[model samples]
Every structure is written in C-alpha cells, then in structure tokens.
Target: MNKHFYQKCIASALALIMFFSLFAGANPAKAEAALNINADGAILVDGETGKVLYEKNADSVLGIASMTKMMTEYILLDAVKKGKVKWDQEYTPSDLVYKISQNRDLSNVPLRADGKYNVRELYDAMAIYSANAATIAIAEIIGGSETNFVKMMNEKAGKLGLKDFKFVNSSGLNNRDYKGEQPQGTGAEDENVMSARAVAKLAFHLINDFPDVLKTASTPKKTFREGTEDRIEMINWNWMLPELDYGYQGMDGLKTGTTDFAGYCFTGTAGRDGKRFITVVQNAKDSSGKGGYKARFDETRKMMDYAFSNYSKEKIVPKHYQVKGQKTIPVIKGKENEVKIYTKSAINMIVHNGDEKNYQPVLVLDKKKINKDGKLTAPIKKGEKVGYVTVKPKNGEKVSFLTGEDQIQVDVIAAQDVEKANWFVLMMRGVGNFFGDVWHGIASTVKGWFK
Candidate 1:
C-alpha cells in the first residue's frame, strides 16, 4: 500500500476505536451483582416512585398464596370510594363462605352461620387475619358473587398493566381447597398466581391510591365483632409489624401468604427516615428447602436491608439543568437562530449511593415540532414542551419501574420565547438563501470539472 493510503487506513482505525471507546464508557465497570434473594421470585422497589431497585426471577409466574387479598382489598376500596358499597352495609354468609370459615385448618375468623357482619368488620378480618371467608364475603358484596369478583380481579389487573398474573379466587387458595364449590369461572385445581414484579405493582397501587388501607394493614391485632359472643381476636399474619417479634423498625401495612402450592410469600413495606420501600418475596425457602412464614419474611428482610443500606431518594437531574451537548436547539425563521432548552422539573428516584455519577441525561426532542434538519420553526413559546429528558446508567444495565411504565423522566421545555422573524426579515432571508444555494451549486460544478 502507498504511504498516504496506509496513513488514511491507520487514521480510520483510530477513529473507529475512539468511537467505540465513547460508548463503552457508558457501561459499568462491572456487571450488576445480584442480591442472592432466596425465592422463586423477588423484587424491591421504591414505594413512592415505584422505581425497581432489584429483582430476581421477578417476572416468573408463581402462586401468590394469601397475598392475593391485596387485589381484593384494592377492588373493595375502589367500590367504597365510588359509593357502590358502604362500610356499614351488612352481609349474610353464603354457603361457600360458611363452609370455608368453619375450616379451622385454614386461616379464618370463624363466622356464625346466622350472623350478620358489616363491611368494615369483614375487611378487618380479611386484611389483618387473612381470613379467607371474610375475603369471599367482601367479594360477594362487590361483585354479587365470587365468580364475578374473579373477573373483576383479572380485568383490574389488566387495567393496572400487571404482567404475569391469574386470579382464580378472591382469597389466594388452591381451588381444590374449596372442594367442588370453587368460584364459578376457575378450574378446580387452579390457584392465584402473580410475578413478584406484578405483586409489587399491586401493592404500590394499593397503598398510593388508597392510603387508608395502610391504617388497617398496619394494625397488629383487631377484634372482629368486639362485645359479641362470636367476636374473635384477629392477629395479623405479617410478623414484621412493629408490635411483632420479627418487627423491624418502620415496618407496617402489608400482606403474607402461605399454601401448599404457593409455599411462602410476603409483600412487605416499611418506611424510615422519610424513605419507604416495597418488597415481594415469593415461594421463599431456606438452604434446607424448607419454606414457611419465617422464610418469606427473612428473604424480604434481606431485600429491605439491601435497599435501606444502599439506596436512597436522590435528585439525579435538577430542574432547569441542561444536557452538556444539547443545551440548545436550532430554530428556523425566528428572530433568534437557536432557543435554549432545559428540564422543566427535577427528577428524583431511588438510586444506589455513590452510583449517581453513572447516570447521564439524554435529550429526546419531539419529532412533530421539529423539521427534517432537526430545527424547530418559530414561534416558540416559553416553557413549551419541546421534548423530554431521561436518565440511564452508563453501564447499560436495565433499570425498570414496578408498573412496567417508562423510566422516570422530566419534561424538556423551551427556556424562553422565540418570536417569528418580521415579514421583511423573512423575505430578505429567503432571498439570501436562494442566492446562497445557487452559489453552492455553481461552486460544486466547477470543483467537479477540475477533478
């Protein structure tokens, strides 16, 4: 090869190497390490933002056990809010609920065959004690039948954007546990199932949309039918409550589940020092393969520890901040040739401590407002939303939100107005552009002839 050709080739190779190096810099120095959560599926997320901080087999479908009540709770709360039901409304036990309630082997706050219970009492039993019969009773009240309630559950799951879920019953029990009287639409052997991620999403919405649910969920114990002979002391199944033995500080208001098919599962939430986290551990087990109530809480504790110890709500992108290379965009036919742009609001999310430096802001402009040359034509208004800015890890590791929504972002807006140029100025510019194009065409032809 000639010397000039070899030089060009070396220069091209160097350019390619530099280009790859720039992208490679965005990758983390090491692969994302797992939390080693001992469960069939597990996930951890910031309670307020719903930003997923960690996950393990989080998308895998598995039995949810009594954690299924969270959905039932959600629906019932929605019904109450819409005035479709009232806390003082009375309920008469159905044949199925009576039979299930009498089964002392399962979780229950036994109901008298002829007893009349109100909505608030039934909800207390269902939420705190994981009472299967009470859950069914509430389901019946809202949907007119447990079968219809299951449909509502599935439909609501779809509306919530839940992925990997199936609701066969209001209570998270294997249908066979009901003998031949399972809810109308479900198979005899079917059980409620949800991915850890979906369960977290359910819990997220439950707490956010109906914050009052936490008031009852956090109750360590409550009396069902207090002052009546049928009254029962309903102890919460969630051992992590502040008044419980394994109680972690700031722990409160969540659900726990256990069944032969589902093993042990818990959807837990805790808040401390102005930060809150939601965690899900499904089918948790120990090294000996023994799964039980303690195992689920233990796994959840590990996740919470990881979250509280390592992650915190940090303002990764500040309001009015400008991206390094995208501080402004070109404008056409405007008094100003360019308009400055910045984030409309600050973006705060759960992030690992010391890892904030790895995130970089990326500007995404709205294509409808910009022309082919990537220039916006005036007149632009101040604070107009021109696009949005999202942040991503430099290491290319995927960061997901619990709701399966887009990553948290801030609006990218014009910082000031860019008025359209005067008519005379526009005409003058048009003439100048026409002459400039003609001169460029002539110059190109002459240059090609010389070549």
Candidate 2:
C-alpha cells in the first residue's frame, strides 16, 4: 500500500474506535442483574435514610395480612409514651376478644373470659406471637373499641405519610375471620391491605421511632400468662430470627404473615457492619409457585443479600460542599455583594456500587428569605439556613424513599455573614446607580442612532 493510503487507514481506524468507545461510554453496560425476588410485591430500603435500594411492583396495593399490626404497635407505643395509656393498666376482655381468643383456627394466646390482662402482657403476646385476641385487647384499651382503633390506624397511616393502606381491624386478619363480628366500620370480606412501599415505611418508623419494639419482636418464645393454668407457649412465627432453624445473622424484631388471600408476607430488618436494611415481600412464592413461611423469608433474604452485597451508605455530598454556579447569592445593601453558601450537613444515602457519580445535589432556597431574583436581603448571618439541598439522580432514574415525602435532604446555609451597608454608603450607592442608569440610557440612544 502507498504510505499516504496507510496513514489514512490508520486515522480512519482510530476514529472508528474512538466513536465506538464514546458510544459505549454513553450507554454503559448494566451495572448488575435485576434482583430475582419471588413475590407479587417487594422493596428493599436503607434503614437509616429510607432510600429505596430495590423494588418490584412496590406501589401495587396488596393484602398485607398481619403486617398491619405494625401500625397498631406504633399507635400503642405512642400512646404509652404520651401518657395516653399505661403499660401496667389492666384491660378486661370483652365478648369479642374472649370469643376470638378461644378460636384455635386463628393465631391466639387464648384469653380467659374473666381474665384481666395488663397492657404490657397483651402487647408482648401481640408483638411476639401475633396473637389476634391480645392485639384486639390492646386496641380496645387505646381506641375504646376495635372499630375506633381501625379509624386510629387509618388516621395514623395518613399522618405517617403512608400512601397505600387500608386498616379494617387492629389485627391483620381478614374481616371474614371475624365471623360476622368484625369491627363495625368495615365490610364483611375486607382485609387489611398496604403496598410493599407502605409496609416498609411502617417497619422503618416502627424500628426508628420505637427501637424497643425489636426487643419484644426478637423474642422467639414466651409463655402467655406465665405460671398460670391458662398459660400457653407463644412461638414467634418469624423463622429468620437468630435462634430459629432458618436464622439469619443480624435478623431481629420483624413480623410475618400468611393467609389464603395474602399468601406469605414478611417485613424483615437486619443490620450488619453498621448498615441496616428493611425488606418487605408480599405474596412470596418458591420456584414451584408455592407460598409458605419459608418462601417469604427466602425472598426477603434474596433482597437483603442483594442490598448488602451491592450497595453501601455513602456520603454522596459532603458537608460544606458548594454546588457549582450556585455557591453564592447576591446580597442587597450589604458590605459584600454576595454571600457564599454551602450545605449545612453531609448527605449520606444508600447507593449501588459504581453508581455514586449518577447523583447530583439540588438547591432550593427559602422563598421568604430571598427575593424573586434569588437575591438575599442584607444582614444575613453566617451559618444561617437559607434553604435546603436534596439529592437526585443525574440520569433521571426514579429514586423513591420509604416515605413518599422523605427525599434525602440536608440544609443549605450561608457560609459567611453579610452585614448591611451604612445608610450614607447606601445613599451614595443609590446616587451612583441613578447616574449610571442615566448615562447608560444616553449611551444606548446614541448607539441606536448609529445603527
């Protein structure tokens, strides 16, 4: 080949390779395989930040089964904390609780017709054993009746920012299980329902707002009415407990649910190496399409494994970090024309490995503190919060927090003080601006004439 031809060929080949490399970089290989979660609905979230790490059909409302009790637990705990109810206060079993507690078909710790169980005892049975009757007794103590408790559940769900949920009863049982004696405000066939996202949110708040609940939830075995003739062994249904046959390390205080309608469902939380995750699996099944206790835990384990192996809590945006082109805001009538601003705290979020660069910070200033042009008034104090900063994916991938409203955020504050200019200085500046505007107008007119 001629020398010139050889040179041209080499350049063409180089160009082709560069083009392909750019194309490949633009559309990088998929980071990892989609999690193989076997469930109708599922979600995995960082326990600390509520950042959703993985999800499948998480918004579709489905039967929550006994997971509904987490809400009841939240309310009861709040009541106890606020002095609305006492742990030592005793509750007399009503006819409904008495009858339901005796039913062997349901998960119950058989209550005596004349029994006066304390709130603490009933709470243990409900939290550890998923005792339906015990749950109802606690609900009655708080809401005065199961019907009222259902209202409280829905109300609290709204306040907690849970989007998809319906509470027909304090216990998660289908209303039909009530045998026509269901709570008054619900339909005969209605069952407690919530989306996987909402379930995870509930679990998140349950553990965070009331960490003590885990102590009771982790109990594998407790005797109801211990030392009494009516005492019965209550074994926790959560097989993932560290003491159980299918135990997983770091597993603690969570709930499990199963029903013909809801199949097998679980809301599980585990922590390892200072990182914790909350996972929810609804209608979980095995390879053979079989739903069982083990199936729920298996599916949950899959998600948990995917999270711990592939993701980590990273300080995506460091404290005092300033956003480009937004590091300062113009100050009106100040010693300095502008004030430097930076994040008040670091933004730590759960992120997939290799995806850290995908996120960017967004600044939203407080409207009341700034003018329409985003200029701040004079006399701004150092470290004063002017707005907030939230993180969003640069690639536009949807990022959802456990609570719909809980986007990971930190405060944006002024980095330095901006004192107001003296009145004489302000007056002189105003005169200068007026003259400058007059001169600029005259110059513009002259330029127009030339044009």
The C-alpha RMSD in Å for every predicted model, in order, reads 7.1, 4.1
Write one digit per residue (lDDT tens) for candidate 1, span 1-451: 7999999999999999999765443222121354677899888889998887777787899999999999999999999999999999998899889999999999998887888999999999999999999999999999999999999999999999899999999999899989999988679999999998899999999999998998999999888888988888888999999899789888887999998898889999999977999999988998688897788888888888877987767888999999998999999999999999999999887777667777888889999999999999999999999999888878777776775445588899999999999999999999999999999999999999989
Predicted structure with the largest lDDT when compared to the true one: 1
Show pairs that collide, candidate 1.
26-394, 27-395, 28-395
TM-score for candidate 2, please give it.
Answer: 0.90
Best by TM-score: 2
**Regions more than 4 Å wrong, model 2:** 1-33, 446-451
The lDDT per prediction is 0.89, 0.87
TM-score, every prediction: 0.86, 0.90
Tens digit of per-residue lDDT, candidate 2, span 171-232: 99988888999999789999999999899999999999999999999998998888989889
Q: Which parts of model 1 are misplaced by more than 4 Å?
A: 1-35, 439-451
